[model samples]
Target: MSKKNKDIEVRIEETNRTIKGTNYVINQLSIGKKLVGEVMTLGAKEHEAFLGDEDLGSYKSVDLAIEAILLQHNLHD
Candidate 1:
């Protein structure tokens, strides 16, 4: 967490869930305990990013998915 973005606090953590034989970890993006988005692995190299209930898009990696979620959340700082 950086102090530069003081308006909201962003946090991502692992969840106990797996799909399609992929032991994926769902990162819940939250702002001060309020969940705004999520990122999870679909299978192989495919990852899914979402905001609220809307699908942001499919990504190739977890980092990319997180980036998309952050961009959609407008928390790029």
Candidate 2:
């Protein structure tokens, strides 16, 4: 594939998580190290608030970001 085409591609991986007592759908993109993005399609205002806080903002890489999300859900077990 061409470099130009690669830049337009977005690969997403889905996982279930819960933040602040509500379940959320987490989407992880296979992009650059610091290019992690997330979307929570199911949750209340508190869940969104927690996700936007400084504790979640400390992750600097996509892998770490995913890890942080997993940790939030206690999914590591």
Candidate 3:
């Protein structure tokens, strides 16, 4: 295969893998695997952060953010 064709094939494979991973994560979250992990930040202000419509209070700190998510999941269960 040509180099261009090989690159395209690689991209297609990567896309397929990403789609599969996303589907698996969705399935797990649906099964109640909430509070996955904490987001790594360089500052106090977050640029982009959201997980569904889950109102998980304010982000006081990384630990607090994680704690709030855990509480949310515990309460929902």
Candidate 4:
């Protein structure tokens, strides 16, 4: 595996799981071994995503949140 692939593999091994039909994740990101940020999805179609302890807010769809969050971080950078 490539270095990026290895990094992803190490972080994501058992963090993905499904209950009912909705997907929940306990995502942890790090640079090498140093801790970074974490995010989580809660609920079904209509849901909220959390960043650490902050509310990223609610969205009608994950796609919407994905676009909005990416744009948000891009602005920060």
TM-score of each: 0.71, 0.38, 0.36, 0.43
Query: C-alpha displacement of 33 in model 2, angstroms?
Result: 5.9
Lowest-lDDT window of 10 residues in candidate 2?
Answer: 43-52
lDDT of each: 0.81, 0.48, 0.36, 0.51
> Which candidate wins on TM-score?
1
1-77: candidate 4 lDDT, tens digit per residue: 65553423223222665768877764444335744334455656664544435567877765665555545544654
Ranking of candidates on TM-score, top first: 1, 4, 2, 3
Estimate the TM-score for candidate 2. Answer: 0.38
What lDDT tens digits, residue by residue, belong to model 1 across residues 1-77? 65574566678888957566767778888878788788887677888898888898899888898888888777633
What is the C-alpha lDDT profile of model 3 across 1-77, one tens digit per residue? 65553321101011111343452111112223333323233245531122346544446455555455456655765
Candidate 4 residue pairs that clash: none
Report the Cα lDDT for residue 21, model 3. Answer: 48
Residue 24 lDDT in candidate 3? 14
Candidate 4 segments whose C-alpha is farther than 4 A from its true place:
1-23, 26-39, 51-53
Estimate the Cα RMSD of every predicted model relative to the unseen true structure: 5.2, 10.9, 16.8, 8.1
Whole-model lDDT, candidate 4? Answer: 0.51
Task: Tell me how far candidate 1 lies from the true structure as C-alpha RMSD in angstroms.
Answer: 5.2
- lDDT for residue 21 in candidate 4, whole number 0-100: 88
